[model samples]
Target: MKLKVCGLTKMDQIQELISLNTNFLGFIFYEKSPRFVLNHLSLEGISAINHQGKVGVFVNETIEKIAEISEKSNLNFIQLHGDEDENFIKDLRKNVKKEVKLIKVFRVGETFNFQFSIFNSLVDYFLFDTDSKAFGGTGKTFDWQILNEIEIPIPYFLSGGISLENIKNLQNFVKVNMRENKTLTKLNTPFALDINSKFEIEPGSKDLEKIKTFKSLLK
Candidate 1:
């Protein structure tokens, strides 16, 4: 499983996460988020990192604005954590020339469905997170069992309430789910695990020791 550390803000915290060789690092651009990074870190500073390219996270942001931030930040990926429609993402991709990966995040709830056939063709990947009216960084876990009922054609990342204490349990959950339905293997997909608020001491401030210890388990 690939590890993605989200809600990055400080340069020191960014460096620490890079040292862990995390697969992806996310920077929140949403102004409302307590973990917002656009005001704290400059585009050049984030691009200077030698490892783990940055991902710009946005919520209900305009396409022009997203494009501007992506260029200025030199972001390698965009994670849409808002209620962006499929047409919006299609246009955003057409406007940007960079080899940008698009990650569309869906907030899971009791009625949440994984009808990938509707939007899978538009974006590169899906990120499942817990649903909250305010949007991500809620640090709450939705039922992992819900994933078993959906059909995801593209690769995805599992987010929401993930922490050091529950990661092993999550892995075990996936393994057990796989055992129950052998057809799931036919999906032939690589699911990345996204870790956010749980690894932080506070909003935008990550706990390196906690991250390192959690990563050690993967090894």
Candidate 2:
């Protein structure tokens, strides 16, 4: 499984995450977030970082802005974490660089309906996170059992409230899913695990040792 450490801010922490071979380093572009990348690091500064898995998180942002920021920040992926519909995704796809992968986020609440036909061709990946009014960084987990109810066509990143304490629950869930006859043979397990607030010492500031230990435990 891949590990994506999101809401990164400090350069040193970014370097530490990179050193740990973190698959994706996410930078939040949403201004409302306390861990907003722009508030801590300059676009040029982020652009200069030599990492292939740099991701920019946006919430209901304009296509123009997403395009510009993706280019300026040298983002490898654009994570759309809001109420962007099929048309919005199509438009954004046309505007951004072809090399840049798009990861459409679905905030899972009490009930979720997987209608992925419209998005199958538009995005490179799908992210399933806990639903929240704040868009993200709520650090609250949704019922993982909800995932067992659907057949996800595309490989997705499981996000929200992931930490050392609850890691075993995910492991057990995956084990059970593996044995399920209904699980699609064509669909693989979750592509990655996206973690944010739970590993942070504070908003945007990651606890290096905790993350290091989490990775070690996961392995």
Candidate 3:
């Protein structure tokens, strides 16, 4: 599985994470977020970061702004962590560069039933996270078993309360799904893990040793 360390702020930490082989570096554009990247680094500063997995996360943001930021910062992926519908996604798709992939996040709470056809072509991936008023980074996990009831047509990133101690249990989640005959195919497991608050020394500040251990644990 791949690892996406979200809410990056420090340049040194970002470089170190790249050295540690973090698959994705998430920069939150939502101004309300405590880990908002722009608060710590300028757009030019972010643009200078030498990494292919740079992901810019947004919540109900304008398409023009997203496109502008993506171009200026050279983002490889745009993670929409809001209630953006198919029309918005289609429009955004037409506006942004073709090389930029889109990851639509579904904040799962008690239940979620998506009409997969709408998003299958609209996005490159799905990101499942805990539902909270503040938008992610809550360090609270929803029941993973909830996924067993639905059929996810696309590969997805799993977020919410993922810590070193609990990551080992993901195998069990796969096993349970397999036993239920729900998935032994592409949807068998999450393509990546989107980690945030759990490994942080403080909001926007990550603990490198913890992240390094998490990466090794994934191996």
Candidate 4:
């Protein structure tokens, strides 16, 4: 299971997350989000780390702005947490040629349904998060059982309310319950465990010891 520490803001917190050797570090670009990184930080500041690719999180942002930021910041990926259509994703891929990865986040709720065909051609990966009108950083856990019913085409990251304490439980459950399921294996699917609010002292600050413990457990 790969760990992605999202909602990064401060340089110190970024350094700490990098020290954990987490696979990915996310920077929220949505102004409405509490974890939003200020524009002054620049792409250089965010990309200063020797490890972990910097991801820019956007919500309903214009393509021009996303392009400008990707160019100026040298961002490795774009995480679209908005209600973007397939056309927008197609355009983004056509415009950017850095083997740019796209992570399309889906908000899970009782009414949510699995619709992979709509996005299968557009994104490199899919991320499942708890549904909220306000977007991510909800700190709420959705029913992991819901995944059992859906058929996804691409590799995905499981998000929402993941902490050190529950990671092992979740991993065991997925392995035991999903191992024999043909639909899951048919896609050649790879899943990553995404950690967010559970390891944080606040929006951007993470507890290093907890993260270390989490990494150890995963190992």
Scored against the true structure, residue 118 in model 2 reaches a CA lDDT of: 84
Q: Candidate 3, clashing residue pairs? A: none
Q: Where does the lowest 10-residue lDDT sum fall in candidate 4?
A: 181-190
How many collisions between residues are there in candidate 4? 0
Winner on lDDT (1 vs 2): 2
Candidate 4 lDDT over 85-197, as tens digits, reads: 89998888777755778989989987567565789878988988888878876778887777766667778888888887677767766775556566544432336777778
Q: Give the TM-score of candidate 3.
A: 0.94
Global CA lDDT computed for model 3: 0.89
Q: What are the per-residue Cα lDDT tens digits for candidate 1 across 1-219?
A: 788888988998787777778889889999998988977888788777666457889999999999988887888889999988888988998877558889999899876755556677888888888998897777988888777666677788889988877877787877775677567434433377788889888888888888898888876
Sort all candidates by TM-score, best to worst.
Answer: 2, 3, 1, 4
Which residue pairs in candidate 1 collide?
Answer: none
For all predictions, the C-alpha RMSD in Å is 1.9, 1.5, 1.8, 2.2
Which runs of model 1 end up more than 4 angstroms from their true locations? 180-190
lDDT of each: 0.82, 0.89, 0.89, 0.77
Off by over 4 Å in 3: 175-186
Give me candidate 4's TM-score against the actual structure: 0.90
For model 3, give the 10-residue run with minimal summed lDDT: 180-189
lDDT of 2 at 215: 90
List, residue by residue over 129-148, the lDDT tens digit for candidate 3: 99998775789888898887
Worst 10 residues of 2 by lDDT: 180-189
Ranking by lDDT: 3, 2, 1, 4
Which residues of candidate 2, in runs, are more than 4 Å off? Answer: 181-188
